[model samples]
Target: MKDLYYIFDPLCGWCYGAGPAVTALAEHAGVRLHLLPSGLFAGEGARPMNAEFAAYAWSNDQRIERLTGQPFSERYRSEVLTNHQQMFDSGPATFALTAVALTEPLREVEALKALQHARYVDAVDITDIDSLQAILGRLCLTGAAARLARPDAQLEEANIRRIGQARQLMQQLGARGVPSFVLQVNGQSRLLPSSAAFSDPHGFLEQVLAA
Candidate 1:
């Protein structure tokens, strides 16, 4: 079987823009798709969502929307973006995704896509554990939800390990951003351009598969 690794941060607007293309890759025969959360907006990378950051994010989000035709709701702009109470951390989302992978390995990608949609199109705040729990329940992934709500040290360690590995991979490839793709064949890994994930996922897969 072929292996494809998608490195992304759940809070990234461009990662949401890459959604459709990732879905297409998931449907390919003889290919196993893996999601690696870069945790770009997690840990030290996280910050408070003040007006300054909100304005900057919305501007960048607009560019992604135009490029990918993905929806960025007004409610998200008003409620989620403008909220300054919480930090813009991808930690919760990334940890929740790790929880899903631990229990339901096959649905990891599905869980990622669901979380992305809940944030962008549905205008929900997925940066908090409670919101993430509700999303997991809605997606009928209660196992992951339970794990998310009461995260044990094992789960926490797993999340850290995964994110660390992803960071290491990024360093190896000299990748500077999220939504990057890597194809591994016979233990040789090749980094694919991140731009194709935003604009042409199908062609991106073709190029990866061809390589």
Candidate 2:
């Protein structure tokens, strides 16, 4: 089986923009989809929401929408990006996904999609543990939700380890951003063309399978 590694940060607009293609890849039977949270907007990389950052994010979000046809709702713009009380952190969401990975591995990407939708479409504050837990529970992933609500040392270590491994892989590939695709076949790994993921998702999937 081929191993298709997807590197992404939950708070990244571009990663959210590439959601459809990644979701399709996860559903494909032949390839084993690995969801790696890069943690780019977590820990030390997290920042407080401010006017300048909000403006910059919205501008970039607009570009992503034009390129990928992913909607960035007005509510998200007002509630999430401009909400000064909330920090732009993916740590909690990453931890939630790690819980899902440890329990229902197949549903990791599903969790990610739901989280993205909650943030961008529904304007839910995914930076909060309560919201993330609610999301997992609503998805009927009770085990994962329970784990997230009361995290153990194993879950903490796993989340850190996953993020470390993802960062290491990014360094190895000289990749500097989220939504990166790495396809492994016969012990060989190659980076897929990033442009196709945004502009031509069908072609991107074809390229992955063909490779």
TM-scores, all candidates, are 0.96, 0.97
TM-score of 1: 0.96
Which regions of candidate 2 are displaced past 4 Å? none
The count of backbone overlaps in candidate 1 is 0
Put down candidate 2 lDDT per residue, 95-208, tens digits, no spaces.
Answer: 999999999999998899999999999999999999999999999999999999999999999999999978888888888788888887787777777888888877777778
Clashes of 2: 0
Best by lDDT: 2
RMSD in order of candidates:
1.1, 0.9
List per-prediction Cα lDDT, in the order shown: 0.88, 0.91
Across 28-68, the per-residue lDDT of candidate 1 in tens digits comes to 88678888899899999999989999999999999999999
Which consecutive 10 residues in model 1 have the weakest lDDT in total?
Answer: 202-211
